[model samples]
Target: MHDLIASPFLNSFVVLRPGRLEGIALPERRFRELAQSHGSGLAVPLWLTDAARSRWGIDVAPRPVSHAVHIRDAPVYGHSRASWEINLGCDLDCEHCYLGEKRFAGLDAEGKQRLLLILRDAGVLWLQITGGEALINPHFAASCRLAHDLGMMVEVLTNGTRLTSPTILESLTTSRPYRVTVSLYGATAETYDSFTRRRGAFRRVTRGLAAGVEAGLPLRLALIVTAQNAHENDRMRGMADELGIPYKEYTHMSPTIYGGAESLASQSPAHLKALERFTGCNAGHTFLHVDPHGRASMCKVGRDEQIDLMAEGVEGLVRLGAIADRLMLRTGGCSGCRLSGLCSVCRPLAKRYQEAKAPLNTYCQHEQKGDSG
Candidate 1:
């Protein structure tokens, strides 16, 4: 997959041209099928051709040109930090939402201000606004403008219910969001409506998507996976394909310890484990969730989210973020396990392990079941 001749052009020292890529493992048959399907298996990024890269304004290749141990020694296409959730108060009672209904039940005014201040001062280059529904917040537009003014691109993740207005569109469009991610529950009304429990919500989400597309805004899709709907992941993903929106699927993984999916958190361990393989707790590194109560966690689940940002303040928390980096680099347990593409213990899960001596993982159990079969 990596060729030495291609290293100089694509290595850490030299930046890969926006659209140019030198190393890719597309040489395999199975991988080729995946490429023609699921985007080159995350190994090869679906990239624009060389000429197209010039227009897209990106220099990072979707695939690596080299196999460097250190990211510093490897090529980087994006910024160092990631877009994190600062607000959690939401109005919708989404059955599969990671931000449980209680979290978004409401937000204290003081807590909101504290989070905004933290994001603004953290040298954060990209800020994402999410909530029960970020757009519903009274000061949503003003807040978006504030973040945009700070020389950072603002990204919004919403249910698309409140964005059905001209003014809302204007405010968001003016901000030039990195992308507006809309959750697509199902391809059909019956399927989607049943899950959201909002009769006309499916229609509204579709309409909002059309308006966003017409406005030339980028769109991403979030598909929730539950026991009732787990078998339909591929089907929902196909819907995103039809809509031309990149989609990701998430299972309501509360595991009891982290307020998992209300009634089904205790789904068979085997099923939970399968999701864990791909949906492993990437909390500390991949995401940093902020709740309405001003609680913070690298991941949404895990009781250790006891890390209160309102108490620590932004300075202390930014410093603490390095802990996530350390936790990610760790190579043990699920994290350290040498399974190909298995989910490891995210920060939240690690906290669980420390707090409770029990190993109640679905992934491990699922694999064991397969062995028995």
Candidate 2:
């Protein structure tokens, strides 16, 4: 990765460092000047050199623009963020996975590279690479490196089971992700292993966590509270505390993305937290999601309409905003509901619950409505 990444983020321009959360915004003229300077073999600007020294404690003196800065081209699309499921495969089988069936399949190395370039060209500044477990994918490291080199800050979502692998650790520490979020199932070995149905899972995860912390990775914990592991919620918090890392708890459960209700069986009834009121969101307007097979959707929960990226390329994204609008309409079971305004989830998510025939109380506040399908 270059020392700094300069790129256009929708209407604005930004400079970011890999693995760092902080960023510097630049005016359009200044950004264009840098681009021109790089093209003309001019020296790096003093302002950027000073900004690097003060903000990140790095001295970039007398370096050419081509060497010190990597600039990205502006995109036709206004999108600035996206999430891609690199592969829908995991090492452990958790009881409440939203993916439902975790199959090992996705694009090949060349296809993956093409997709990343498409995302870069689409002006995706922040990209989340996820999976059944992102680390298990053979092309994950290469993808991460390519994304960083292309001026996008990457975040990886993993289960922490493979953090102990020297190869995985070296790859991440070298290229570095802005964040690596790991799922925390339980505090104890028995509870964790039981929940995931994977023997020795807790041991491997703990070791991986230690390795990540020691390597000074930007790590966060996602505490997954379910019926099998709800009793250990407090202990799980303590575990995150002991590691000196930040964490967030997930008490509510949703049906599988494919509208399968099987994953809901693990919901902890007593521990379910009230969801925040649903306001508006930008879903397909400013962000998009891509499945393992290079299918792009509005978001993870609202995937009724998808564009096959491998088939149509980034040009396929042109129709996504319209799809988002259609999916948001209150039709079908939600048509003319008295309490539609107070619903906590968007239409696409509520549709999934309805398809799964989930308990009304699990998602809806109103009493029984006949034939929601």
Candidate 3:
């Protein structure tokens, strides 16, 4: 594998290392030239060679384009990003998991390969492979390798339980994803294991994290703060700080994907933080999500409408933009709500909250206004 990856990120171009975070931006013209030079046996430009050497300490001199560079071609589709759930299987069961019922099921090998290629053809440059615990998926290594070979910057969303496995570590070290994001439950085993309802999970996760850091893998942490472990919030932050890993905290717990209120029970009533303003998002316009069965949706939360990739293939994504539009409309319980414009949650999320019959204070400003009779 080449030490660096040169690819088109939507309308722009980037030159980045596979396992490291540092990267360089390349002008479109330069990117086109490099891509077109592949078959011509043209040597890589000195500018890139110099940048790689100075920035990443890798030498690419005296090597032709075919050998030195892996330039990914621009896609024919307009979409640029996507996330896929390889499977719903998980080792530990967290109380706040949005996927309430974690079924260990997904597409077979042939179906997975087909779905990945469809993602590439649909112009997904940045892909996130998530799961109940993505690492536990039997096909994870081969599927991850296929995604990289397809020229997509892959990020694995894992639980960190398997990061210490020699086979898993070797696979990741070899192909090297752009990032491996691990979820942080708590600072101590008592809190973590209790929150996940699994014994010895905290030790396994810490060991995995240590192994990952030692291997110089690009790792990020997602601090999941829930009622079960909210007291350790400070300790969790401290752990990330001590590890020198960047982290984002998730304080609010949402309803399950199946519109059940099970996950909301785990919300930390006193610790819930105000969410950032919900400016509009480009869910289906620029990004989409796919379930394990190759079913595509506007995003993770907005799964009301879906496209069956296995049946219609990538061309089916043409309808995703329209689905996004319909899903975002202020209909159903939100219809004519004066606070629609300032609502903290999107329409789809609001719909899920409505379905779950969650407390109004959890998602709406309407609760404060009451019904003005």
Candidate 4:
């Protein structure tokens, strides 16, 4: 069997033939030299190599390894990273929930397993099992095990409410998710419960995070910013720090996927611009999000345009690609605009403005300055 190791520092993968361990983190020049001398292997990204190995096992050699690099730059349909919302029945009813009050009806266990197999066949190496609360789904652990057994790396997104249960904790241990990200709404119980509208949820979530940490699972903390808990952001960071876990903060808020204008306040313009500069939607290109019912879209915000995964199976990816291409087009006032470079307004948000006939000023500072051509 060919041995492969991933180097996060280099953002590359090293291929070895059994006993070729010259140590890890080799410099690029030395790595290239080794690849040249080895004749059978080449340098490639971990995601590409992992996908290949997962799909084809040892039978797939490292020939023309350079092609893998383009997987991120120019993804091939059906061969990219994916996230599936195993179930949308989240326990928390936060005001900023993008899904709104929509009831979730997902595939049965047999059908979900079938979907995983289809994704595995389609070359999806990285899969995230998320939910209203993934742990709340009876089949979540089974799904994680299935993804892992299929050679896909699994990540779980949860609010941490149900994670403290003994049964759930045991299931998580067995399924062995690569990482578990807990959403921290507030640093204190009062703010958190107020945001979720569920009393005692904060205590439960914190306990769940502690349980995962005690179980030796890789844990990450994410703080969801909203008008209600904006003041608690720093305290939440401090809480994550106290827990000794990596933390991320996000401020973007959108109307519900069902187009409900619940109308919570949004982040400030300066904050939005700074955040947008660093983030871009990767939807159809290299990433896809699947809802509980198996509807696949480029991203959460782009859910309006979707392909029913159960109906199309692997071929759904092609339809999604076509949809993404159309969606990526610059429409309305955005087309031929000189400030498009500085504008953080993406295609999906722009489409929202076009449909609502709202001025771009609502979404873009540049547009507010009359920069649109």
List the candidates' TM-scores in order: 0.61, 0.96, 0.95, 0.76
Return the TM-score for candidate 3, rounded to 2 decimals. Answer: 0.95
lDDT of 4 by residue, 319-344 (tens): 77668778777775567767666667
* Full candidate order by lDDT, most accurate first: 2, 3, 4, 1
Q: On a 0 to 100 scale, what is the lDDT of residue 329 in model 1?
A: 51
Candidate 2, residues 184-208, lDDT tens digits: the string is: 9999999999999999999999999
Which one wins on TM-score? 2
lDDT of 3 by residue, 1-373 (tens): 5666788776678987766767899998888888888889988889888999999898998788778777776777667899999998899988889998999988998899999999988988788999989998888999988887777778999999999998889888887888999999999999998988999999999999999999988899999988888899999999999998999988888899999999999998798888765888999988999999999999999998999999999899999999999999989988787767667899999899999999988998866568531
Q: 136, model 3: CA deviation in Å?
A: 0.6
Candidate with better lDDT, 2 vs 3: 2
Order the numbered candidates by TM-score, best leading. 2, 3, 4, 1
TM-score preference between candidates 3 and 4, better one: 3
Candidate 1 ranges with C-alpha deviation above 4 Å: 1-87, 103-114, 227-239, 251-287, 293-295, 302-312, 318-343, 350-361, 365-373
Best prediction by lDDT: 2
